[model samples]
Target: MPSPNALRRGRRLSSALALGITAIVATTPAATAGSDGRFGWPLQPRPAVLRHFDKPAQNWLPGHRGVDLAGAEGQTVLAAGDGIVVFAGTVADKPVVSIEHPGGLRTTYEPVRAEIPVGRRVGRGTRIGTLESGHPGCATACLHWGARVEGDRRRNREYLDPLGLLRLTPLRLKPVRP
Candidate 1:
């Protein structure tokens, strides 16, 4: 058996290792937008990120599945990547547009007035629609951007952080000193 201090040290080392692995995965080629895999901001100059992705603990649980970008009503919304318009209509009375990209990924923009019809192939940064007035829980007009990975039926569909596709700098873990 190990001493309590030793055990604690071991656990800390394990945690640090796990976090390091996560960072590595996040920065890998499969993780970000690039020549083969990646995405762009729906809003040029990248508007302020009003909200971030907050995945729920369960599939049926309530959580913010996407990011909210600060934008004025009627601001043009662009496609994050090259994809086909799979859906462009009203859902629950809110105008929504969904584009299916490569790798079975689907990006969605809500409260947008659709400018293009379904089956349209849009390139990255292509104008897809305009921001609308109502944004569910948002206090002001904002574009809600969401992405979903499509595959395997065994598990529920997973919602990914849109920021992950931005190819951002790796998160650094700082050391603690006494």
Candidate 2:
């Protein structure tokens, strides 16, 4: 019969193996990048134009948290990918919608003007929101489509630039319309 120490070692090895397998299973899908195995916008909206805009209204200091898309007030906004609308309503002092994707991506549209109830599921490039009218003193109305990773909205730094995730090459900043 195996000694006590020998049996304990066997148990430890078994536990470790189980943990390793679990980790592998969890990451396999993500490691593929996405369902279609591609990261960024799944569709070419507006012909995939690569036009940049003025500096964002907010950023993560060393990094930008969201991508400021130059849009007219009330211009239709689309869901970056297929996901369920986890939140919809005026919160955080502005109208916003949060969508959770299968690949763990989430988006919060700042100052949305469109109507969409919470618990609604949205598809890639589906119109889920619209940009609100810009501030009186401000130049133009733009969409602050921010990405909060993994449905964790509490962390400000947890946000990512929607442009980066969309995989567009950075272009020259366009002047903000008045």
Each candidate: RMSD to true structure?
14.3, 9.0
Give TM-scores for every candidate, taking all chains together and pairing residue i with residue i.
Answer: 0.73, 0.58
Model 2: per-residue Cα lDDT over 116-143, one tens digit each = 6778877777777677865323367655
Pairing residues by index, what is the TM-score of model 2?
Answer: 0.58
Cα-based lDDT for every prediction: 0.83, 0.59
Tens digits of per-residue lDDT for model 1, 1-178: 8999999999999999976665554444484334344578898767889899999988679999999998889899999988899999999999999998765667899989999999999999899999997897778899999987654462646687777667455679999999
Pull out the clashing pairs in model 1: 33-38, 34-37
Worst 10 residues of 2 by lDDT: 42-51
Error of 1 at 107 (Å): 0.4
Which number leads on TM-score?
A: 1
Worst ten in a row by lDDT for model 1: 28-37
